[model samples]
Target: MSEIQKALVVHAEEAERIGLPHGGGFRLLADGRDTGGALGANRLSLGEGAAGARPHFHALSTELFHVLDGVVRFTLDGVTSIVAAGGLVSVPPGTPHSFGAAPGSAAELLVVLTPGVDRFGYFRALGRIQHGLGTFDDLLPASEQDRYDVHFV
Candidate 1:
């Protein structure tokens, strides 16, 4: 029998293991190497004061953020914009961008990274840090971040 390889069969414990905590921050439904898919997709939920991600630039992929609830503050190429519920923001490739939840409010959104999907591993590793499963300094050296195809924006 051919071995079946896939990700996404996640339970609460499994979700917690792969960088998701119960009702915390984000949940990754599919990543680059998981399920043999090319696109990196994730469902992110940021509570008050939570930043969506480190401001960074992708050398070769465009990103899109579709808000599901609440308000989100998105910064693209140094300009910040507020997106309300059901709004979507698209950041063109090579733009320096990031997002965060509004202070004292919550936000849920979908994030998609195209072209370079393996980049998802960085976030997964970061999740390990968030879960107290590992220690990463406040800043991850460019050497490490570059391995996951990220660069300072």
Candidate 2:
């Protein structure tokens, strides 16, 4: 018999949420291991004026963001743009980018990393730092970030 494939389903109430320092949060949907390395996914909810992500790039995967609510501001390679709900952005590997809620607005986004990297640990680490249980420096080492494919510039 051949290997069996199973579907993965994450109900809204069942997703794990990770809180960020600025009142935002991440609802993890699936990690690489859960999807057999096809993709990792999460829903990011940003408070008004909250920073979603600082400038960074992935060396091994393309990151895609689909705006699920409100407006978001994105800085891609130093250029800034405003994306409203329903907008989608795909950043290729090695391209520097960052994002946040538009000033005075709250935003929600569905984020996906293709050719997936197991990023749940990174998200959990961020939550730890946000909660004062860990330091940002803990994630600065190459061994730490490399495992998630996220590189800070």
lDDT of 1 by residue, 54-151 (tens): 78887767788899998998888989999989999988777888888877778888787775466556776777777887766633687665666566
* Clashing residue pairs found in predicted model 2: none
In order of appearance, the predictions have TM-scores of 0.75, 0.94
lDDT of 2: 0.93
Q: Candidate 2, 24: how far from true, in Å?
A: 2.5
**Candidate number achieving the greatest TM-score relative to the actual structure:** 2
Decoy 2 TM-score against native: 0.94
Which ranges in model 1 have alpha carbons more than 4 Å from their true place? 1-23, 35-37, 131-139
In order, candidate lDDTs are 0.71, 0.93
Q: Measured by TM-score, how close is model 1 to the native structure?
A: 0.75
The numbered model that scores best in lDDT is: 2
* Predicted candidate 2 versus true structure: per-residue lDDT over 1-153, tens digit per residue: 854657999999999999887778999999998888889999999999888888999999999999999999999999999999999999999999999999999999999999987999999998898889998899899998798899998
